[model samples]
Target: MNRAWRTVFIALLTAGVVGSAAWLVFVSPVLGVREVRVVGNLDVSAGQIRQATGVADGKPLATVDAAEIEDRVARIRRIESVRVSRGWPGTLMIEVVERTPVAVLPVGGTFALVDRHGVVIEIKGVVPPALPVLRLDRPGPGDPATAAALAVVGALPEELSSRVAEVHAPSAETVSLRLRDGRSVVWGGSDRAADKARVLVTLLKRPADTYDVSSPDVVTVK
Candidate 1:
């Protein structure tokens, strides 16, 4: 009401607003991260992901950079993709998708574990039994033949894949599989892979030295 009193009131109000802003931005206990949670990881351990994130405990959640954390986690060789988010109150969540190896390519003395995209995910002296060996004269991730063979391997149902010991791809047009029981499957190229897979699954029930799903509609057995 009075001019001096009004001035004092405005000054006090401004100080309170500034103080609240500072407390929220610089010193709020409720905004600090107390936990980091990891999800969707198979091969990668949760502790490894947490370490990769580089998010320090008790740091302000608002200051945590999701993009930076995701980029750091994505650097792991086995990780296919990652999503980092800040959970309200006191948690940071990280979700990771790891690359699944579908085949092994013998390169030099070591076998390179490759995913469906033909990207080499890992390498070791011995190939894993669950993965089929991929035979390519010159194996490159971007090679058409390698991609086609990988596509075929990726499409095979678990039952069918269990019986396949190796996949031979000399060229994009000549994709074939060698079964564990000594039968061969001529899979042709990557085209109509799902159809070929369906035909081959049914055709394998019969006895044959070689099964051709090269032209799945008109398959031949030898």
Candidate 2:
């Protein structure tokens, strides 16, 4: 064949290939979604996540808008973050990071569950046994006192947290903890939290009226 004809033939072949690929990715039913999968959910149910995504079976996976789906999923208060993606061949995948509750706040006879970021996750009529109650004069996401209490709550070891009944943050610099057994702990500010937690844990072994680990290096018991 002549060089000109050969070049034309190659161009037509490339165009056909690109067109076919575009059709498969953008318009074909072969890549359509048959299933929607959810991962990383704890407090929220998988069914709720699927509903939030607004992704239906038989929809084109390539056409699903990940950012829009994420926005929808994020509307659920318990979800901290969400990632939406298309699973090749026949699935739509949604991964979620649920907010971890650090403390609960009593509001008008209901309990508000809040994460370490001080964002309220949910409100329940009854307090959950696992989380400690947070005592702040004014509790809100932007409150400095709530943030300080959250820092201290988040820093506490699991062993200590399990024994805690309430967290008090009168001011940003003044934080304290009340244990389930009626013992009081003066935790002070959020600084040196790990050291303070360790000191408090050790001091809890001995019976005392008040345990002050605010200055971990110079702990006091009253």
Best by lDDT: 2
Task: Pull out the clashing pairs in model 2.
Answer: none
Scored by CA lDDT, what does every candidate get? 0.90, 0.91
TM-score of each: 0.89, 0.92
Any runs in candidate 2 off by more than 4 Å, and if so which? none
Off-target runs (Cα >4 Å) in candidate 1 are 2-15, 22-29
Q: In terms of TM-score, how similar is model 1 to the real structure?
A: 0.89
> What would the per-residue lDDT of candidate 2 be over residues 108-157, giving only the tens digit for each residue?
99998889898888898999999999999989888888889999988988
**Displacement of the residue 159 alpha carbon in candidate 2, Å:** 1.7
